[model samples]
Target: MHRVGLTGGIAAGKSTVAARLRRLGAAVIDHDVLAREVVAPGSSGLEAVAEAFGQEVVTVLGELDRAALGAQVFADPMARERLNAIVHPLVTEAAREREAAAVADGSTVVVHDIPLLVETGQAGHFDELVVVDAPPELRVQRLVASRGLTETQAWDRLAAQADDEARIAVADVVLDGSGAVSELEDQVDALWAVWADRHPAGSAR
Candidate 1:
């Protein structure tokens, strides 16, 4: 399979690129989805998180209270590191398993939509790394406008993620995400065409 890693900062439009790639026939393994799966209620991940951060971060209904946890970790580098240490490995293992299943199912192009690809040091695992590029300020505005986060909250979330320079430095393809949605989708379509040419369907790699 042609393993592609897709990543960007919060509100930088990585998910939009992944959705476009999905419509273009790439098998997408969204890591954020996997992350939630790994930490689902009654999971070892959730148990570990509770053990580390206490039950306060978990809801009465047994799911994670993301807002509570984010409030704790987003402002503290060490706490965020601890959270990553707990979750990243689990997410990686789950993603690897998911990719294996996709390959077995005859997937030729597999795009892993991982928001923390650079932070988790998984960029080298992909055949191509696509970073959706946007200025932090623009992303901050997007978050505030769309997600209802205060400007400070938006910046705090961005601060929790790896900076643009780090993501761009490791990127094989950088798609501009500062423009209109259609423009961004057009960039993804262009890249997907190149990828489809390189990894034709039903061809043994």
Candidate 2:
């Protein structure tokens, strides 16, 4: 199977590309979804998070209070690193299982939708890396408009991850995310064509 890594900055339209890839028949493994699943109410991930960050990060209903936890980590680099140390391994293992299942089910293309692939030093794991890119200012504008983050909060979020230059350095393909949705979709279509050609269905890996 062809393992493709999809990543981008916060609010840089990576989700849009991932959705298009899903619609176009790629087996898309969303790490963000797995990240949440690993930390569900009864999970060891939740227990570990509570052990490190405190019980205040867990909700009354036994779910993780993501916003509460995010507030603590986003402001402190060491705290963020601690959280990643707790969560990244779980997410990676879960993603591996999902990809294996997809390949066993005859999926030729497995797209891993990872927001922090670059930060995690996982660019080499994928057969090809696609970086969805937009200007920092535009991403900040998007965060403020859609997510209700303050300007400072948006900037802080961006600062927590690798810069565009760093991401681009490892990318095999870069999709522009500063344009309209249709434009992004077009880029994904072109990308899907290449992936499909490289790993056609029912062909040998």
Candidate 3:
């Protein structure tokens, strides 16, 4: 399948772009969704995380306390590295399985919606990279409005990521999501046209 890597900073509308691609017949694998699945209550992923971050990070329900862990990693570089060491490998493995399954199912284009594609140096995993981009100020505004994050928290999340220029530099396709949904959909459809022509039988690597 034509595996296209989709990514953007927090609240940059990567999910919006992914949904548009899905509606246009692109098979989409959301990394955030897969990440959560990997760490479901009794999963080995959770156990590994607990071992890395300690039992205090695990909730009474046997799930990871995401907020607490986010606080830990976002504030401490070493802690984030430690957490990534435990989770990144599992995410990568799960992503590979999902991608392989999608290809086997005859998907024409598989879009991997990963928020940390650039930060994690996973840009080379796909046939092409598409970045959903917007100015940092707009991203923070969207985060506050949509996710109920305070202004400070929104900026903090954005600040933790690679800058907009760095991300755009690596994008083979850049979708500007600072406008209406229809505008974004048009861009998605445009990309789909290219992908369809390139990988008609879903045989792209």
Candidate 4:
């Protein structure tokens, strides 16, 4: 199976690309969804998080209070690292299981949609790395408009991740997300064609 690591900064439209890839017949493993699942109520991930950051980050419903935890970690690098320490391993294992299942099922391509593939130093793990890129200013604008983040908060979020240059350096393919949605879709279609040539659909060994 062809393993593709897909990543981009916040609001860079990586999700759009991932969805398009799915529509074009790629098996997509969404790491963000796995991250949430790993920390769901009653999970060891949630327990570890609560142990590290205190019960204040858990809700009365026994769920993780993501916003509260975000407030604590986003402003502190060490806190963010600590949270990653608790969550990343679980996410990685879950992803590996899903990828293995896809391979066993004869899936041709598996796209791992990881938002922090670069920051976490996971780019080299994929057969090919695809990065969806947009200008930081554009991403900041999109974040403020769509997510209700203040300008400073948006910039802070951007600063918390690896920069465009760093992501691009590791990318075998870079899809420009600053243009129209159609353009991004076209890029995904082209990528799907290339992957199909490399490993024809339903032909995984």
The model with the greatest lDDT is 2
Measured with C-alpha atoms, the lDDT of residue 175 in candidate 4 is 94
Window of ten residues with lowest summed lDDT in model 1: 196-205
Per-model TM-score versus the true fold: 0.96, 0.96, 0.93, 0.96
- Over the stretch 1-205, how does candidate 4's per-residue lDDT look in tens digits? 6788999999999999999988877789999999999999999999999999999999999999999999998889999999988899999999999998987877778899999899888989999999999999999999999999999999999988988999999899999999999999998888787776776653333
Better of 2 and 3 by TM-score: 2
lDDT for every model? 0.89, 0.92, 0.84, 0.91
**TM-score, predicted candidate 3 vs. hidden true structure:** 0.93
Local error of candidate 1 at 178, Å?
0.5
lDDT of 2 by residue, 1-205 (tens): 6788999999999999999888888889999999999999999999999999999999999999999999999889999999999999999999989999998887888899999999898999998899999999999999999999999999999999999999999999999999999999999998777766766771332
lDDT of 3 by residue, 1-205 (tens): 4678999878777888988888777788988888898888999999998888888889998888999789888867788878777777898899889888987877768888998889899988789999998888998888889889999988878877888898999999999988888888888888777777776764232
Give stretches of model 2 more than 4 Å off.
Answer: 202-205
Tens-digit lDDT track for model 1 on 46-97? 9999999999999999999999898899999999999999999999899889
Residue 173 CA displacement from its true place in model 1, Å: 0.4
Candidate 2: how many backbone clashes?
0
**Could you list the CA RMSD of all candidates, in the order they appear?**
1.8, 1.9, 2.1, 1.6
TM-score of 4: 0.96
